[model samples]
Target: MSVPKLLIFILLIFGSSTAFAQHEEEKFDAAGTILHHILDTHDWHITDIPTGTDAEGHATYTPIALHLPWFFYSSRDGFTFASGTESLLEKGYVPYHEGLYPLKAGVSVAEHMDDHGHLEIHMEEEAFKEAYVDEAVTVIDLSLTKTSLQMILIGLLLLFVFRGVAKAYQRREGQAPKGFQGAMEVVIIFIRDEVARPYLGDKAMVFLPYLLTLFFFIWFANLFGLMPFNSNIAGNISVTSALAVLTFIIIQVNGTKDYWRHIFNTPGVPWWLKFGIPIMPIVEVIGIFTKPFALAVRLFANITAGHFMVLGLVSLIFIMSNAGENVAGGLGIMPISVLFSLVIFALEMIVAIVQPFIFTLLTAVFVGMAMESHDDHH
Candidate 1:
């Protein structure tokens, strides 16, 4: 064959093989499948059971199960159980559960219990009391849960980094900052001069700790979420909601007497107008609550939406290839998908920094509004 023909043949073979491989991988690449595996299964530590019998010996040697950081098992049809034999027959393989009972090739007979097992039963009950109370539902998986761990880790990291910086400064005792200390000093000053001073003025120092911590903590969490193995804790609604509530509380607690009086009882308004102005106060109160709600939703939605979009784009390749005839079409779309992924990745970097800034800025604005004094110059 000529060089051109050989090249064409090679391309055809490579393309055909890649298509087949991708088709197989696509089964596990569905929207939530990869995420579920990562969140639930990846680095999952499973304890092994002993296979061999002990000294008195029904079976002299039992199979010993060891804990593994990673293991793969299909949950498609669900797990199984067996009687006496320690063999589990699933997908034509005899797999051991907990390294002991060989799961029989069938549906699991074991009843699923909630994390707490407060409501333990085989079947659902109609009566209120009999109904599975699902204690597990309320019992949060603190270790497995993303938000708690993220917050704890972020807080610790901030303290460590800040502490280190402080120590470095103390050692230098006024000399120019070096290395990490210098970098952090620059960032701290920038935030103080650019972010805090401009917004909060001299009183900005009062909120400096909170503002700095909030900015860096959020920025770190956002960046962490973008890491391959890290969880999207800030993207979680509950976490964002808590942060929003904190901001709301601060705004309310720090509100000046003038602020409250203006909302509850407008000073200059005529008596008849003030008495009739029931709707304004209601709207004003609603607005107060809505501000924090918007803050929470904005941060949560933006972070979550970015992840979903990236996942969706990657999923498109699988969906199209699974359609069979669209091999060429899918191949054609790969570059576009990759391009968009790169773009989004870059955008995410900006968002990582920008989101915390926006959050802090809005927080300061809200605080300023609440503490605004008529006596002070505009």
Candidate 2:
């Protein structure tokens, strides 16, 4: 056949196949849109494309997404491998009722019939909890999620950068810093002098490696999240909590005799207070976990909240403009959305720097507290 006819034939085959591939995606309500942007999922959602009607004559929109692998291993199943979420669904899961189990296939989760005659399960409810609580939890998700991907990227970026700097240092032995090395030297010196020294004292050098890594890693992760279509790494509580746990572990492991004594014994407190009250040591012990908890929550909240605000502002454009389908509305809303988003984006960048500093500084302070002598406290 001719080129034009062949092209037409190919289009007809594929175009008809995708007709019921999707439905007109539900409109993004403010809260849902904001949450969706902040929350982690199994795939990278790029955009949606319109398709023909479904059997029920509903307008369809096909999602264009990059899927991540799903890894689940159970004793019964040995190890199940699915290249993507769709594959997982085809393997066993059907519509995801609870705990990766198919609806009506096993555990019953509460469902309700909607006005449109559809069964809806509120996954946020007690039914989900009930379904999961007794279920044999055999699957371990080793899959790389969006957050996982971002973290790996951040780690590789840090590795590539500092490795180059390390080599630069070796090459330049006694010479002056140059290029990226010089720029990084300034930041490194700033961290060592400003953040680590004041708090960690002479032990600043001892803790500098971790403190420097924490600061730069966090800062990098925050900035990475700010990029368009990137996962919100800093905003993920799991990621932040893991970072805080590292600091906690390091602080505890490296804690001086003075630190343990300060926790258990009364240095300056009265005997009665130590024995009878027991509040001081209890408070001190609790403070250890609480400080790290605060670090995690603060970073997570600040980054997540900023992202939510930015997403909200951007979503406002779509809400008003409807992707230029409404020209008058688009013109009216575009400038407002852009202006506010830019302002928040700027603030978020500052926050990106400030939060990492705060985490590192507080970590230094906690370490110093643990290392400080009784004489030092006074």
Candidate 3:
């Protein structure tokens, strides 16, 4: 068979398996299911096995989840640590909505899923606090979540891969590159010559490490998100926000006097815009913030959207089948849906690589802009 034919066969098998696997749920909430997969959770969820039916006749599946250690601080209890949710619950904490809350008396942790498939937090913020503990009590979540653990693993993977590449360079000094090292050298040189040097100029070496780390971390995280049973690290806004903040800090710290002066009093611009209304200065200050904001949102949105597309397409099979109640309908749409999903999966792979490149290139441009001198511009 041709490669395209083989690819279609693989997608059909994968999609069919996924669709049947989801049949365990009596009722499928497509949005809720998608959100559950994309969002961070306290534990790593492997799969769900049908146990029995609930009182309402809805199917119940016991989730097979892998728990990470829980470490959080509560004003009422001071410091607390537990191996996982069960242990934490033993310590009077309940894992609710990806957070650990104190399980107070006369309180219930419940979730309401609407007909439209949106999950409504059963408790209001104040009510939630009242249920969990006293209003004055504060909880600080220091626990390792699914997303956090994935990020840490990605960091370790980068270390391992690059360490090998580093050794190859040292051992084969002055020799032509081969295999893995050659492939990595292509990327590293691409970033150094095409991204870092172009923007950072003579100071490329100074910022190369940070740029490389930023690029590889994001690219690895994105790729991992596409893998089976892996957390969407790049899709999480908090992760992207932290990365943006790092870039923001680097830009500000490296900002030359000329950079600030340009923001405050943009050269060659109307003095009226600078002094009379302070419009130029205001816009410049806002630009400083918007740069990082754009960086964070772009990566997070792009990555998240790709996952949503892939999940949504697969979900259509189950939804149309009505969780196996209408298997005929599902079979009818299966081919089209799976075909679209396969197309999207291919595109997402490209996006997984391109998004990081864009992010790193922009970072270099921003930093280089900060290091610009008045004399250089003139």
Candidate 4:
């Protein structure tokens, strides 16, 4: 059979098996069970307790709940805090559910003055009930979340790398670039030629650093999301929204006087038509806002969808296991999962690089449009 025919046969077999596995797994809710195991078993370090056996053959206290690493935590009450790690787990406590972190019920020991002396008070879990805590806040808002720290470090490293390259170029004058400088020179040159110059003209150099930074940061973040136990920083809508807002700001601020005037006052139109022409400008302004919104949503949706698809595919095994280990299920599903994962991995690599290109390309297009001069045509 032809390659296409073979592929189609494989897909049909894979799809049917996947559906059966999902049905089997659904009977026992294997996906939920597995998810809970992964999420809950991970420590977020809120509080710790001791519960191990002692040398005297009696129950002894051993440190638990030592290090809880959480993304974000907030309370409906006035009190709020973001720490490097959840501190409550050092006492040997575990998360209430499998994958859900109770951000609000964070407990800490407090000192209170009493008649005898200083007393340590353990805040009851009920205290948080009245407090109304929300751990679902944006990971970016979390104090020293691993993802946030990684982004910062990535930014600083890129800065130093680029700066060093720039210094080398300056010192070498007209000589050929070498070492790290040479490697970066090639990339910068590609960005200028392929991405920036095609859209932004001679003035593109001014925006090169911003474009480079935006591309590398986002690309790296997306790649990082694929790592085991890593947070999906780029997959989060807020991060993409912030990037879109920046693009919006740049497009508006860099807009020339003519750009605005053309919107408000058309150069060639009838007296009656002038009034109607202004509507075009209003629409144009709205378009500017919509462009960035589209950018943000597109990136976030694509990244997130890819992740969900991969997870769903991987979950097939546990689902099929419920049906008495039918060798057909494992024989069928594992190869499909492996195959699709490889394909998706390749796509992700392309996406990591392509997303940045599209973002920077659009930003450049907007910037170029803002800087256009009608009179220059004459």
Winner by TM-score: 3
lDDT (Cα, 0-100) at 309 in candidate 2:
68
Off by over 4 Å in 1: 1-144, 267-273, 323-332, 376-378
Q: What C-alpha lDDT values do all the predictions have?
A: 0.62, 0.75, 0.84, 0.62
On the 0 to 100 scale, the lDDT of residue 357 in model 2 is: 92
The residue-by-residue lDDT of candidate 4 on 78-132, one tens digit each, is: 2234322224233212233222233334543232323333232333455532343
Clashing pairs in 3: none
Q: Candidate 4's error at 134, in angstroms?
A: 11
Off by over 4 Å in 4: 1-79, 82-146, 163-175, 178-180, 266-282, 323-328, 376-378
Query: Candidates 1 and 2: which is better by lDDT?
Result: 2
Number of clashing residue pairs, candidate 2: 0
lDDT of 3 by residue, 67-142 (tens): 7888889887888888865576567767656766777755543344444333345565676666565455577988
TM-score of 3: 0.83
The TM-score between candidate 1 and the true structure equals: 0.65
TM-score list, all predictions: 0.65, 0.78, 0.83, 0.64
Instruction: Give the range where candidate 1 is weakest over 10 consecutive residues by summed lDDT.
Output: 93-102
Residue 239 miss distance in model 3 (angstroms): 0.4
